[model samples]
Target: MELQQMRYVVAIAETNSFTRAAERCLVAQSALSHQIARLERELGAKLFERTSRRVRLTPAGAAFLPAARQCLDAAERAAAQAAAAVGEVRGRLAVGLIPTVAAVDVPGALRDFRQKYPHVRIGLCVGASDDLVEQVREGALEVAFLGLPTTVVPKGVNTYELARDRHVAVVAPDHPLAEESTVDLRRLSAEVFVDMPAGTAGRIQSDLAFSAAGLSRDVAFEVTSADYMARLVGEGLGIALLPSAYVPRLTGVTTIEVIDAPSRAEYVIWSRTVCTPAASAFLAILGISTGPGTPDRGPVPGSSVRVAAE
Candidate 1:
């Protein structure tokens, strides 16, 4: 019946081991077992089926699990609301960013967010768009900036489109197509291409464009970093297709617009189920309005101009 006991039950159910659950709960195994036993006795039902090999929730425990989680979430939200009422945004806010998020003024946003809510601890994690999106869905991150194709947002997440940039082709200055203002993708079908690995947002967009043109590219190299891709293109190793924002400034490389390329859209995404005060504050700093659900808003004030993605 106690919140602590509920936490113990939920942790034990999740971990499936008393020893591990006790470790997670920061309590002795004996004490955790005692509490669970007490709860079972009070409820007049066995909540868990424990064996040496594994632990699992019994019928009653399985039925009670969701309510236990709801109670914990409600309690946390209540505490956060109380803190917000006092205009205090104080908690850990884990924000995820793609490796090439230079389009957003992340540092400046963080600086202003910290200045306004000094007690809010911020943790930034850089990752690929897919991985970051999964983390947001799993509640591992409060929010993230991701580069996505024109696709539906994940079911449990809400996204606000931040910006969109056209995909462009980069090549050595001496390359035949370098002088052109724009070129058709079909013209480059025979050339070896340097590109991000498959499954990345940039790579997916490039693939779609090529597929649309009924062309296939010879991928000479698969790189993860945009800067490295630029370096390879600058060395004349291979031509590359990248989001215009990720086209690096290099003396030997020239970027030309892809005449019929698919554009990459950058979005700010978060779980629809949870929105902490710190997360809300960060969104506000980015010029997004947080309400009952996700709202479509404009760019961050003074950040409308596009910048090269690092």
Candidate 2:
């Protein structure tokens, strides 16, 4: 399985059209089809099911897709390591974060990273802490920002603690508790709440807090976006408990300090297995160690770039 053949297969699988995939690969439709046919002949299985109207991966293709992508990533990483060995950084830096990230300015961080390594490509993903951690563990993301209850630490990824803060109550401007300067878990528990989906890391922080306080709160609205949750709270749907640093920015809501609040810790996590040079450089900006051999501010004048991956 040549990388180009695999690339054609991946592009076709993603676009679900031979014509579009050929366009994406910058090759002719017949040439792309010939390659796929050759790949199928070598693998002894059809990779895709082509119909008059649509294209879909066959069972064999489903099994091969993930490994194919992994191969492509590994190949790219190998090239990046070689470049890093010679005072240059070139690779995609995929980053993931939750919407509530507050410890470091993401755009600013990317700006600084770009200024230093213009050759490196950057990508961003916004997701829940749990999901982001999983992405980092899978090497789908080079780094991720997470927020979880202080009691819980991510299981598989390498992490660096950024900061910690208590949860605050968000109530609509016209709600009865809007004027309150401080509240407790028990008090907040008495009211309905708007929160992230149950069982999520973000929701669990508040859940654990109230559960420990022997209080049960009703989560009347389950939303994925924090901004949308704040909108629901603004409409008096329910109150919410969010990290103190994030609630201040929500319009049409009053933030009350939670006297007996749940505290959450922010973490920056990266793949324990593959720490690319670009990733290490980004981490270094935050003073986060990328194990050994991490690149410094930029490429060294006369030295090869440091390869920090374990």
Candidate 3:
């Protein structure tokens, strides 16, 4: 079927409402319906099961959607490559990051990239370090900023170590340890904690540190958001250990330097297969260089520091 038909189908499937899809696609509902009907007739199978209350993909539609999406992405990349040959950099720059990214100011970096390459479409996703690395490797995201324990290395994607810093203790203002200027892991471990979910890259650093010291901690609350973790500490729900860079911005809490705390390493990762021109430009803007490509990547401009992500 036509690319336009595939676009309409994807929009409808994503929105699950014909009216909403039409609004999103900037097309009339009737025209979208007409295109889907025409495509279904040509394929000899209906794509969607429509009812008065809801619209969902049929088995045929579900089977065909993945290829349709791949074709659309490939078409966009082809167009981007063609534009690149003409000395123009205009395409999607999909970047993923963790909530506690501290090395480079993400908003400032993105703002500069936008100012220099106004034609590029920027996309952002926030996730855990492991998930972001996987997204970069799979081509879902062209670049990502991650934070993990110093002992662990990101696998599969190209990585650049950005910064390394120790975690600090966070507690409510009236908490017993709030008056302390510095605390070590032994003292901090004795208190209940608010931490990231178990087994995630975000949690691993602290987990490893405590284990290495032969200490055990009681995690009273587990959350995904760093802000929420801070909030829990502020509310006296529990104390927490977080990257030092993050403590200054948090409210209602007191930060205590931890002399022997877990250390987190920040990294910027990009796809090993294809460093899209847009991705390359963003990396250069950060003064990061991944060197020449290995058959699939485009020319990496503004490259100076050639280094591995490990």
Candidate 4:
């Protein structure tokens, strides 16, 4: 059977509905049905059992699914390698970025990347670190910028340290702690805190920071998005502990050193098993000594950016 037919089969298996699969694959439902029928005829077995409400893969289809996926992955990788050889890196590169990075580095980085590799089509998605890591594992993203606790790399992917951003206490300007150049964590022992939801990388770090001081966090609210947390802090909701680099200078919000808060490391992760030419080119752009890549190579002499707080 042709690769197109295999694609149809895989899509159908994923979506569990021919109409939905056809929509995702940008083909007509009739065309997808015909292709699947052709594949079934070639294999001499029916691949799916469809009823009014459900679609189920037959035994043969279930067994053949992995092989079909491998075939498609191999074919796509081959095409990407061939395109790279001609020095034309033109394909879709799906990238995942945590919200902070998306808000800060992405604007300038994309401007440079697009100018340098104009032919490469880039898709950007923003999510939490854990969600982004899962996306890379599932082939939804070719590369991602993740804020993780340890250096434990994602399975089947290579990790490159990108930059280190510090965690700081954010509060409203003109608040009690705003004018202080820096303050220890204990100073806010009684204040309510706005923090990331439990089990997230950010929340874990926040917990650790407080735990180290023999204190438990008094969370005023749990939030999922960094931007939302920042806005909440700006509204005088509560003190928020977040990466210092991403805290916007909102009119009422102020950021100060959380003396003992944990510093977070951001990493660039890409699948070792899947390398597209467009992904490779984007990686190249990220590898250069400029942009977000520069901060990882230790600190430069005369560089204004602080890698760590003294």
- Residue 122 C-alpha lDDT in model 2: 94
Tell me how many residue pairs clash in candidate 3: 1
lDDT of the candidates, in the order given: 0.81, 0.85, 0.86, 0.75
1-310, model 2: which lDDT tens digit per residue?
A: 7999989989999999999999999999999999999999999999999999999999999999999998999899999999999989998999999998876677877887899999999999999998898888888899998888888888887777667778889999999998888888877878999999999999999889888888898998999999999999999999998887777667888889888988888878888787999898888766666876543222223222221211
Which 10-residue span in candidate 1 carries the lowest summed lDDT?
A: 301-310
Candidate 1 achieves a global lDDT of: 0.81
- Candidates sorted by lDDT, descending order? 3, 2, 1, 4
lDDT of 3 by residue, 1-310 (tens): 7999989988998999889999999999999999999999999999999899999999999998998988888888888888888988988999999998876678888888999999999999899988988888878999998888988878998877776778889999999998999999999888999999999998999999999999999998999999999888888999999888767778999999898989988878888888888888888887776576432222234433222222
- In order of appearance, the predictions have TM-scores of 0.71, 0.91, 0.91, 0.79
- Superposed Cα deviation of residue 18, candidate 1 (Å): 19
> In model 3, where do residues sit more than 4 Å from their true spots?
293-310
Superposed on all Cα atoms, the candidates' RMSDs to the truth, in angstroms, are 5.1, 5.6, 4.0, 4.4
Candidate 4 deviant stretches above 4 angstroms: 13-17, 20-28, 52-67, 102-104, 134-139, 150-156, 173-176, 179-181, 249-252, 289-310
> In model 2, what lDDT does residue 226 have?
93
| Candidate 2 deviant stretches above 4 angstroms | 292-310
